[model samples]
Target chain A: MMRLRELAHARTGDKGDISSIAVIAYDPGDFAFLAEHVTSAAVAAHFGATVRGPVERYELPGLGALNFVLHGALGGGVTRSLALDAHGKSLSSCLLEMELPDPQAPPAAP
Target chain B: MKTVRIGSGAGYSGDRIEPAVELAEHGGISYLCFECLAERTIALAQQARLADPDAGYDPLLSARMQAVLPVSVPRGIRIITNMGAANPRAAAAETARIARRLGFGGLKIAAITGDDVLDIIAAAPWKLMERPDETTLALGDRIISANAYLGVEAIVQALAADADIVITGRVADPALFMAPLVHEFGWDMEDWDSLGRATVVGHLLECAGQITGGYFADPGYKDVADLARLGFPLAEVRADGSATITKVAGSGGAVSLRSCTEQLLYEVHDPARYYQPDVIADFSAVRLAGDGPDRVAISGGRGAARTGMLKVSIGYRDSFVGEGQISYAGAGALARARLGIEIVRERLLLTGVRTSELRCDVIGVDALHRGPGTGAMEPAEARIRVTGRTDSLAEAVRIGNEVETLYTNGPAGGGGASKSAREVIGVVSTLIPEAKVTPRVSYQVT
Candidate 1:
């Protein structure tokens, strides 16, 4: 297993209660691998209860990036949220902790 | 191919000033744009304006102009900014005063107005975009400010009129950078593709140092050199809408393909439909290529027609919040911090404090990312934070007061206790028809 951070870098932006995170692959060759493993359901499940609304994902093949818009993610927005990181700027690193199967590893003797 | 160079001066209201001075002095550019307003900034500025008539603009306007005008004005580098916040006329007048004091007479400064649509918003019933069931009337007197995101038309008009400095209130962030392109290239307002490409350039350079390795340094993963004195960004934009993003020679930070790609999607939701007042810009097909050291080429930005509707940011008084923090160190510090939080939580419940929402967090452990997949490590030191949202300032104060009492009564080794309570300013959005808003420009010469 390999951490997603080894394959991509991410940044986070917030508007109201919605948090938008874009995960971009380091190499264009890894784009398809990231797309297959980093599903919206997996991201939503990774965030668990922190994200109260549905997670919508968009793909950008030309840029080799995936944009995830997490609704109701700020705990009622920055102005009202009591979270230490009101903007959820660090949430991008949290999403990077997802473990994925190593493509370089040989297939388990079938 | 004719190309124009534009420099990004300031990213936000409180950004570093020396980098902008460096841009004005060393960076060979025709236009210098400063984007200084945030979502909740105008609302707070409006409250200040209500308190004092001449104090609604950005506090650092004089300082920025004082530092940049002498160098930028003499070199014929036009200045464009949204630093006007809640007051552009006053900001322009102040800039003119600064220019005159600095012996730069006959410098024309234009202030773009009509972004404030409080009367239009109050007169009609518009549905709130965030809350569909609610209307403008639902906010009522609590609405402190309503400023529409203006397009590049007013800024373009000011630039065309030979204004040396153009100050605006509540223009779109990207429009501040794109207006100069529109004016220099003579791009028609109906040219959707050109406008879209210009928007891409603006978005990339709008954040100043973000694209120049300010926010992108990861010790081992992505190493950026000389970040302490990171230089701001500039773009050499062509008449055909393609551009190369670069910074001043020998300045700190880098302008690589990685930095460009990271900033291309910064604060962007859907890459294909980046909604701006000028056009619905499409960046899904945008490509970045490394040209040289500290330079990257950008292309493939397209756009469709605008939505004909303008988004208005409505700022209202939401509620009050009270917070308190205390620290503990040495062995079992995490245990002491957790015990302190539990004590404060129980005290607030026992004291009958009315709170709509409350959060108790142990800093350095799970304050930012709570719930599953957290709390696997034990730290030698920890800080306890107890924050609560209440309807009134008085109730909010009590929430903090309860936590402060924990320093002496509840937890052992609790120290450095601090508490604060303040009123919250909430921001929401609604759409208004384009015809209902009008932009006007007035000039002041030094």
Candidate 2:
């Protein structure tokens, strides 16, 4: 298994309760691999209870990036949230921990 | 081919001033833009205005103008900023005073106003964008400030009138950069495609150092040099709306395809439909290419017609939040931190603290990412933080008082306890008809 951080870098932005995180591939070749594995359902499940609303994903093939918008995040927005990181700036780091199958590894014997 | 070189000085309020000074002195630009307002800033500035009439502008306005005007004025680098916050007129007057003191006589400074739509919003029935069921009337007396996100028209007008510095309140962040492009290039207001490309440049340079690798630097993975002396960004925009993002020579930080790509999607949700006061910019088709050392060329940005609706940010008094933290170190630190959290949780319950919401976090262990699979190994030290939201200041104070008691009463070796209670100013958004709002510009000549 390989971590998402190895292939991509991410940044998070917050507007009210919604959080938008964009994960961009380091190489243009890895864009397809990231888009296949980093689905909205996968990210929604990854965040679990942290994001209270549905997750929407937007693809930018030209830029080799995937933008994920998580609704009802930030614990009621930055102004009211009691979280130590009010803007959820560090949430991008949390997203980098997502595990992906290593394409370089040989297939297991059947 | 005529080109305009615009430099982004300050990103947000309280951003570093030295980087901006560096841009003014050595950026070799025609216009310097400072985006210094955030979502909740105008509301807080309104509260301050209520207390004092002439004190709603950015506090650092004096220091920034004092630092940049002396250099910018002589070079004829026109200044554009949203540092006016809740009071652009006052901010412009302050800037004029600084210019005269610096002996730059006859400098024209413009103050753009009419963004304050408190009365218009209160008089009409507009539904809140986030909460569909609620209307502006529901907020009523709780509303502290209501400012519409104005577009580039007023700013363009100021620039046309030969204003050396333009100060404004609540203009769209991108408009601070886009206005200069529109004025210098004479791009039509209805030219959505060109305006869209301008918006891309504005958004990239809006955060100043972000494009120059300020928030980026991941060490081995993405190493940026001399971050301590990171330089601000500038755009060499052409009449065709294509631009190259670069910084001053020998400045710290880097401008490359990686940095530009990260910033291109930073804070952006839909790359196809980025809503701004001027246009609905489309960045999905945008492309970035590395030109040379510390330079990146960007193009292919598109835009469509605007929504004809203005987004107004409403600031209201929501509630009060009280927080307290205490550190636990040495052997069994994690265990003691957990114990401290549990003790404080029960203490708040036992004392009957009226809290609408509460959170308990161990700083090093799970303060940011809570739930399972977060922390792998126990640490030698941890800081336990307890925060609660309450309706009243008295109740909020008790929430922290309970955590402070943990320093002596609950866990052994708990030290450096700190507590604070403050009122929470909540922000919400609603839309108003574009025709209902009008932007006006007033000039102050030094």
Model 2, B321-415: lDDT tens digits are 99999999998998999899899888888988978899989899999987558666788899999999999998899888888998679889999
Candidate 2: which pairs clash?
none
Tell how far residue B56 is off in model 1, in angstroms: 0.3
Docking class of 1: medium
TM-score of 1: 0.99
Alpha-carbon runs more than 4 Å astray in model 1 = none
Error of 1 at B386 (Å): 0.8
The all-Cα superposition gives candidate 1 an RMSD in Å to the true structure of 1.0
lDDT of 1 by residue, B167-206 (tens): 9999999999899999999999989999999999999999
| Stretches of candidate 2 exceeding 4 Å from the true structure | none
Per-residue alpha-carbon lDDT of model 2 for A1-110, expressed as tens digits?
99999999988888888899999899889999999999999998888899999999999988899999999989988888999998989988889899989968888889
Instruction: Report per-candidate TM-score of chain A alone.
Output: 0.96, 0.95
Per-model RMSD to reference: 1.0, 1.0
